[model samples]
Target: MKIAIIGTGNVGSALAQRFVQSGHQVSFGVRDASSPKSQKASTIAGTTLLSIEEASKLAEVIIIATPPEAVLSLVAQLGDVKNKIIIDTTNSIRTRPEPYATAYHALKEITKSNKIVKCFNSTGFENMNNPIYSDFGGIDMFCAGDNKEAKALAQNLAKQIGFSECWDFGGDDKVELLEKFALSWINLAIMQGHGRNLAFKVIKRA
Candidate 1:
């Protein structure tokens, strides 16, 4: 899989590294070609720095890792990605501690005809790199996309990166719910000392 990660933040870097390590071609999509993080990993053969358009053109799976506010503008710039599978890792929280637009609204507005699977937004960056499932526990990673094929592709990718319980929440309408889950997790991490070690586990007795 040729993967394009649009942002160079913790989530973006972590996902890029994981994908590269998993033997996939990685393009670190960034505004500046000479960014330190982009240059630091230049020695890796298949990892390259590319413009958003180049990344979009070359990669089958494009992960939008930009901050929430930038998502719409970025997608607009990327243009017609109809039928392409997009993994949205954006969260709707701004720097001022105020919530940005909801993921549902963002995705709906930005994605015209693209197949977007919303995942990697609900967990912390630390957990994203290496999510551990203890013997008695597992995390529920929610994904919702209108296209079934796209959702399945995203689910397979998620599982490849150590995510276990990939819950299909049905359609792109529920993207806001996933963002809310992340927001709630942020608050809990601050208050409950939960940090990245804790994740929601759904227990069903048979």
Candidate 2:
């Protein structure tokens, strides 16, 4: 899979490394390819750096790991994403793309694309870097979207990156709920002092 990660921050960098390690083509999409963050991400093996428009145009999957508010301007630079899978990995906790509750909503409305999924927004970047726990194995991931194809791809990508399972959190109407779910993790791990190493996993009893 050709994956373009927008935003060279922790979440973006971590996912880029894991996706590359999983045998996928990874690229960092940035406003400035020479920026420190972009340069650091380029250090990862099997990854390329390009402008946001170039990377988005070349990718099959585009992961938005940038601040939620940035999505407004980013849509213009994303080229034509109508045929690509867009994964919204941003949370609207501190800020959001005004007029839209979350980045997922923003992308869907602005791009007018149904291939959008809200994912990888529910945990810390450390968990994304390494989802494995010694005793329990890979932790869980979650995704929500109206597009079945996009959701399936998001789930598959999650598993490829070491998540044990990527649960479906319902469709488009449930996106805001999923973002709230992310806030729950933030509350437990940061506000409640549970620590960043903690992760969520679902267990079934049969």
Candidate 3:
């Protein structure tokens, strides 16, 4: 799988490393493609550091890890990713003291595209890279996309990264609900000081 990560930040870099270790060809794009972090990440992991155009062109799956403000710009530049699957990992956080990620506006932008999926935004990077949900084994991440096929593709990618459980939270419009869930998790973390040791489990009773 040829995967391109649009941002070289904590989330982007961490995801890139995990994907690479999973035997995928990973490429990372950044504002400063030659910066130390970008170069080091690419070199250490043996992945490619490319321009947005180059990366987008070569990738079958695009994982967007850019900030909320940059997502629109990044998508605009990506042109013609019509049939491709885009996994968005951004949070709409304000500058307030106890910030929460907003998704109403972001969901609006995503509803227009058939190629987008809202996922990997709720959990911290620690869980993103190495998630161990149950003693039985790790579970794949959760994802929601308007397009069923796109969601399936994202699920397959998750499995490649050692994730066996993938939760489908319905249409892409439900993406806002997932982002709101992240805020609840944050508030709990603040109150209990429970770093990233916790995870959500959905059980169905027969």
TM-score per candidate, chains pooled: 0.85, 0.98, 0.84
Question: For each candidate, what is the lDDT?
Answer: 0.73, 0.94, 0.71
- Report the error of model 3 at residue 153, Å: 1.1
Query: Cα RMSDs of all predictions?
Result: 2.9, 0.7, 3.7
Task: Decide which is better by TM-score, 1 or 3.
Answer: 1
Indicate the residue-level lDDT of 139 in model 2: 100
- Worst 10-residue lDDT window for candidate 2 reads 33-42
The numbered model that scores best in lDDT is: 2
Candidate 3, 90-137: lDDT as tens digits: 766542112223332453354355667777776678777786666847
Model 1 over residues 35-74: C-alpha lDDT tens digits?
7756664545567888888888888878888776676567
The candidate scoring highest on TM-score is: 2
How accurate locally is residue 13 in candidate 3, as Cα lDDT from 0 to 100?
82
Candidate 2: where is the Cα deviation over 4 Å? none
How far does residue 139 in candidate 1 sit from its true spot (Å)?
Answer: 3.5
